[model samples]
Target: MALKTYHGSCHCGAIRYEADIDLTQGAGKCNCTYCLKARAWTTFMKPEAFRVIAGEDHAVSYHKHDQAPVKFHCPTCGVHVYGRGDADYMGGPFVSVFVATLDDATPEELAATPVRFSDGLHNNWQNPPAITGYL
Candidate 1:
């Protein structure tokens, strides 16, 4: 099935983008420090599935601690939009989309989808099967 398109942007609406994503593809939750602090629910999609509409220059990248993945955030609002991971792990130049940024996503839509949890806090990132609901 064709993925649905969702619009998203930074907190200050500086960085806007659209993502063609399968709502049923499942989302992810990580217990990592940044994830915890950001309180973000995330999802994965191919790089080609996303399109930045505006404010690309307002985006900043940070690669601290584990430099393998470079986190992208809106410099103006400090909102994390995605992360660019190493080619080996990402299978190419892919980014993990921040599910929280999908402002139009409904709770029912999210509930109907699957979700996976990762123990990133302990650096034990497990790729488990998709979950049927939010964590």
Candidate 2:
């Protein structure tokens, strides 16, 4: 599970960023309100592992709730590029980068990466949702 730099951006290409992601750790699918609505398929990384390479000003920030992460996206394209959050169980501050936003991930890379599910709708972060068919 070696970390590799992944380039990502928004639908309008207004927000560009780089993140050191270890795909082997698996991408996440959560049934939480926000995640379900966003159809978030993301990879988690330490805050230090992510950096904005361009379009900082064009990135619009949205904080859904106190516990929910501060999400950054492009106002023009409205793509949920990434988000920042803190969870003690996840080892403090972290960034969740949307896999769909990756500008240079090969099909093989994605096929090899695993998918992890969580029951976030019920706040049971440790367990997979009872019905992953929808999430």
Candidate 3:
């Protein structure tokens, strides 16, 4: 799919944001503690492609023990929206957006988009299992 801008927000409508995403590239399904609990379908994009349109102050961030990928969520509804990390985790510096927060993304679209499982539980980015599935 071609790159497209997608609008999203937290559960209570706070923390509105937009991101330029290409669903044809697929998403990451990580097995880390946070990812496992949140169960979010994530797609990465450059910071320039992401913008906080409104209610940014209403969003809260949680950092894991490693302080990588600070997870952002809405304080009012406690919904995980997206995350960012300074280091290069998946190719280069990127902002990870949760597809579930996307306002216009359909379930069929999500299912059609591919998924790659990441062994984040062990921090093994080099070679994860080849098992594929959808969120």
Which is the better candidate, 1 or 2, if ranked by lDDT?
Answer: 2
- Could you give candidate 3's per-residue lDDT for residues 1-135 as a string of tens digits? 678888998878978999999988888887767887898779888888999999878788899666468889988899899898766556666899998899988788788888878777778755464453432
In candidate 1, what are the lDDT values of residues 53-129, reduced to their tens digit? 98877789888765446778998888898776755554667767798788778888878877778767766677532
Which regions of candidate 3 are displaced past 4 Å?
129-135
After TM-score superposition, the amount by which residue 54's alpha carbon in candidate 2 deviates from its true location, in angstroms, is 0.7
Residue 40 lDDT (model 3): 73
Candidates 2 and 3: which is better by TM-score?
A: 2
lDDT for each candidate structure: 0.76, 0.90, 0.82
- The numbered model that scores best in lDDT is 2
CA shift at 95, candidate 1, in angstroms? 1.1
Please tell me which model should have the higher lDDT, number 1 or number 3. Answer: 3
lDDT of 2 by residue, 32-74 (tens): 9988999999899898999999998888888977877888889
Clashes of each: 1, 0, 0
TM-score of model 3 (CA atoms) = 0.89
Stronger candidate by TM-score (1 vs 3)? 3
Off by over 4 Å in 1: 66-68, 87-90, 127-135
TM-score of each candidate structure, all chains considered together: 0.81, 0.95, 0.89
